[model samples]
Target: MSINPRTIRWGILATGRIAENFATDLALVEGSELVAVGSRRLDAANEFAERFGAARAHGSYEELAADPEVDVIYVATPHSRHLDDVMTCLEGGKHVLCEKPLAMNAADAETMIAEARSRGLFFAEAMWTRTNPNIRRMLQMIRDGVIGTPLQVRAELGYAAEAEKTRMWDPELGASALLDMGIYPLTFAFLLLGEPVSIVAAGVLSDQGIDVNAGATLTYANGAVANIAWNQVAWSDNRGTIAGDAGFVEMTSRFHEPTGFSVTRGDQTETYEEHVIGRGYSHEIIEVADCLREGLTQSALLPQDESLAIMKQLDEILRQLGVTPR
Candidate 1:
């Protein structure tokens, strides 16, 4: 197979599960190559690079960030480390795609965005769910008036986690039901309806002061509302629905992953399904390639401002619950 010269060279800056999933998807996406993998441990980086067929493996993130051959760096570290990792890459003149909740808080996200802008670099949060084809189609349907004026959106995402052990329950890692799983539903709501005018939230906190289960109601000025819920201590339906004056759209299990959804109105319904390649991560990789080729500094699909706004909402949710960072 011949590789295109225009291919975007991806340098993955972590060897965690999400990093592996994304690299596998990048392998399937044309015009993109995983050129490097970095980890705090040399052996881990080498092993991951070998598994992903990356040409270079570095023991330190700084090495990967400083590599001139790497056109872009994907910061797949934890939420607390995102700002530092992304800024390091940006300082090295490498375009960055940081994982979502772009940072631990909205303030940190603002700093990272400002740094990227100052360097004239491409920076985006890897909100892969926003890049799914079905999501794009659904958003278009809403915009086309197929769903009329969106009046309300109800979405939930959750997974069982023990408050004592997992990172989802750990404050040191910036873990909380809201920051980890909750961001999905929140971002989904924000996508359908822009920033809400007011937010009311309630949460159950663990002994460590991190939220284990959380629910929020967002009110928009146009009378639109969203009920978003997330829990780290129990499983949920993990589905979503958007209701408009005309009809509604319903997504099946795993609202964040590849699945089926239907739009219904007046006894009429249309279903759309997609079986994505490699856990749906390829779609985001394609978006990155397209944007970079077009000389875009940020993705129109997942704008930096929208990401920052979502982070701000998450920060507010945590604040409402009085969960401070460790």
Candidate 2:
């Protein structure tokens, strides 16, 4: 927590597809600038920097972290690299917004969060779904009792990825339906209802021991329950529904980055439309900027503890599926 900069200067730590998307969204945010790009190869970094209109390109992540002009970094490395990549930014005296799943497991996520806490740095997982406009509004409505005493949640997010994405089938890389896709539904349930009391999970594991498809029933203390599933072998409807005694809300297809949602009470249904900025990634970027300018260490919108809780759930689900937690 230093003097908050008027215009946050951002750095990208890996020029992957996520990084490209982030950079695109960052441009849409006010009072933010992408000052630098980093990658293992200088050529890749240079290309990304040029394409993104970044002024500096570092061949190594270490070099990018050391750049004094960079107020914060967005780490877009793979899930397996989050622990190390986030630590590098923290060690370099920079704030960070790392990609989702935070880490391979809760333990590693704890280590990263603790380091950020000890260093008094702002850090967060880039769980953009939480920051999407429709999701935020839905959360408010649920809290306002638009849906009274949410009793059950049904959400599924999946797509065919095993054939085209080698990383999705690699255990060493920490690939699993739970980490890559299921986290949305899990987090969705957690947001609407608090943490569950017990979780019963089952899944299909690949020969490599990574989960290819999984489903879980999470029961809460108040008898609330959530049925969520994810898959890498096929396409799901990608919809989510939260039901309560009074009424319910249905998040449209690709619920994670929802197009919109309708709230139903008896025969009356109210629908809300969403015009998300730059594929909905800009919302998180704006949140990060707001937090930085306000001198907050963590976002209330997506707290560090919540991220850890979801990671713990992810670990438990993987373990139940006979895929050893990485």
Candidate 3:
């Protein structure tokens, strides 16, 4: 990386709430600037651009992707549009940091990875939770045997949403509890247990054909198991626990957000906290900048293979629930 903070000129490809949050966080991170923003509507693009102090605003994704000044593009569109948006950025010769679940399925993620590899452009899924300091510390502790032999993991993330409205219940938007809330716990489990050898799922689908709530049991070959659950029809504790032979780790609510976790061993418990710069999204932006400056095609912290594996897990979960990807 550069001696000075690595400045990455960024173009945002959506004007949604999450995109706005990411832009706000990007501004807080040193060596990063939001140079452009794009939306299907000119006014929305201009509005977001003005709000974020972006240098330019484009009415179409192509315009933002084609901007020579933008060293990279952030794909913050809905999950359904991720593949299209990411492919456009890659084809335009811009590195991409796509929001997760990378695409609607593993096949799409593989295609995106192939394109990035062939083009020699950096590509990564924005699983910002993996970049969080507390999570990193927890993972290190586990690897160092502070947790001893992993036993079982359990997690849940959910919130209530109207079945008649909102994207959470919309089948056409690729909306589901699994894709939204479930991905966090599922990814968390995957990080701890790796790819599971078998998966069993049971869920109740909403009237709109989306899986409103689901519970999954992932059995790993190493004798580790993860019990995960997600719901859009009700609230859950939204906590995570990683239990091991010697100790356990627990995360408070919003496990995917700026987090506070505790490690317990015998009668002693140690708490770890992470501070966010703006909205907690800036940490991932910093990783992207460092990778770009170092001429790396993927972040060591959140590699392409990890993204692909998570997508596969999601695909299997969806399949078990009879929700096919578009």
- Candidate whose TM-score is highest: 2
User: Compared with the true structure, what per-residue lDDT tens digits does model 1 show for residues 1-326?
Assistant: 12245898899999998898999889999889999988999999999999999999999999999987798888999897997899889988888999888998888999999998998899999999999888888888899999899989999999887645556766778787788899999999999999899999998998978888889999999999999999988889999999999999998778877477999999999999877777898998988888888777899987999998898888889899889843
Please provide TM-scores, in order, for all candidate models, with all chains considered together: 0.96, 0.98, 0.96
Can you write out model 3's per-residue Cα lDDT over 1-326, one digit (the tens) per residue?
12234578999999998898999899898888899999999999999999989999999999998988899899998898888999999999999999988998899999999999999999999999998887788788899998898879999998887756566666777787888889999989988888899999999986767888899999999899999999987888888999999999998777777467999999999988867667678889999999898889999988999889888888888888988666
Query: Which 10-residue window of candidate 3 scores lowest in summed lDDT?
Result: 1-10
Residue 142 error for model 1, in Å? 1.0
lDDT of 1 at 154: 95
lDDT values, one for every candidate: 0.89, 0.92, 0.88
What TM-score does structure 1 among the candidates reach?
0.96
Q: In model 1, which regions exceed 4 Å deviation?
A: 1-5, 162-165
TM-score of 2: 0.98
Worst 10 residues of 1 by lDDT: 1-10
> In model 2, what is the error at residue 219, expressed in angstroms?
0.3
> In lDDT terms, which candidate is top?
2
